[model samples]
Target: MNWALTNYERLLDLVWQHTWISGSAIALGFALALPVGWAAYAMKSSPHGAVRQLSGVTVSLSSVLYTIPSLPLFVIMPTILGLGWLNPINVLIALVIYAFAIMVRGVVDALNAVPPSVLDSAAACGFSRGQRAISVTLPLAGPVMLAALRVVSVSTVSLLSIGALVGVSNLGSLFTNGFNRNFPTEILTGVVLTVALALVFDLLLVAAGRLLMPWNSVVSAGGSA
Candidate 1:
């Protein structure tokens, strides 16, 4: 408590750094995943044998990316991306890769969960593929996507701390510093702050989802009643 209070400004800076890295990675990953997931989902049903294989290939590759060890990935990012070892972008890039790998599958599942009957109705109503995707399918998949985003948000927040291992400063630095100095308070503060940050992100995501999908709230209320 004494150290934290004395170093309050430094703690706040690290928290800000952690927030930016996690938030940017999640946002970028979600943006990239949407179209790729749609492509993979659409390709699954293609008449061409090779085209249909694309969906499986895409998902398998994403899973493989997720399986790669994060520490090594962080260390290698500088060499791979031509950034300096200490550059913050190294952490950002590594985090983005991880976020994308996790979110792509979620996007595919969300899209697949949309009812076929609803898609057919959209088609019958003369909606083009793009129109149906944007207007009907996406709205229907909102809850599932929201669930995925929440997961990504929390996971990214938790994961970003690893960046500190490679000289990239974030909340994880506290852990390393505390361990070196044999100070439990610093380590506890890091753990508590990390957990609290993840929870805040999750709550914000839930609030945003409810605000954007009032019908989902109504359905839940009706189900409970």
Candidate 2:
């Protein structure tokens, strides 16, 4: 407890850095997943099936990217992006890669979950591919996407702790600092703070989804009755 109080300011700074990094990764992943997912789902009728093949390849590749251990990826990012070993950007990119790997599949699944009949209706009403995608398909897929966002957001917060291993930028540093000095309170503080961060993110995602998709809650309520 004394160690935690003594290091409170530093701990707060690390907490802010950790949150920022986690949020950036999730945001980047959400942005990139949209197009990748659309391509995977929409490229089915291309000549010689090249685009479809590309879709499969992308899913495979994202999975492989995520399978790489975080420590090695963090260490290797300097070579991959020519950034310094401790550059927060390296952690950012690696985390984004991980978030994307996890969310891209969810995006694909959500988009595909839009019913064929609803899509056909949109087409029959003279909606173009892009129009149907924007107005109908995506709206229908909102719940799934929100669920995916919730999952990825929590996962990103948890993983951001690993950035401390690089001893560069994050809450994980608290653990490292604690262990180095043999301070149990510092270690406990790190664990509690990270868990709090994840819980906060999860709640925010849930609230945002409900706020953005009131119809979903309504439908669920009606179904439950």
- Candidate 1: tens digits of C-alpha lDDT, residues 1-225: 888899999999999999998899999989998888889999999999999998999988997898989889999999999988999899898888888898889889999999999899999999998999899998888899889888889888988888889989999999889899999999999999999999999999999998988888773434544
Q: How accurate is candidate 1 locally (lDDT)?
A: 0.90
For each candidate, the alpha-carbon lDDT, in order, equals 0.90, 0.86
Tens-place lDDT per residue, model 2, 113-168, is 88899999989999998898788998999999888888899888888788778767
Q: What is the TM-score of each candidate against the true structure?
A: 0.95, 0.91
- Model 2 scores a TM of 0.91
Q: Which stretches of candidate 1 lie over 4 Å from their true place?
A: 220-225
Q: What global local distance difference test value does model 2 have?
A: 0.86
Candidate 2 collision pairs: none
Output the worst ten-in-a-row residue range by lDDT, candidate 2: 216-225
**Regions more than 4 Å wrong, model 2:** 1-6, 45-47, 219-225
Clashes of 2: 0
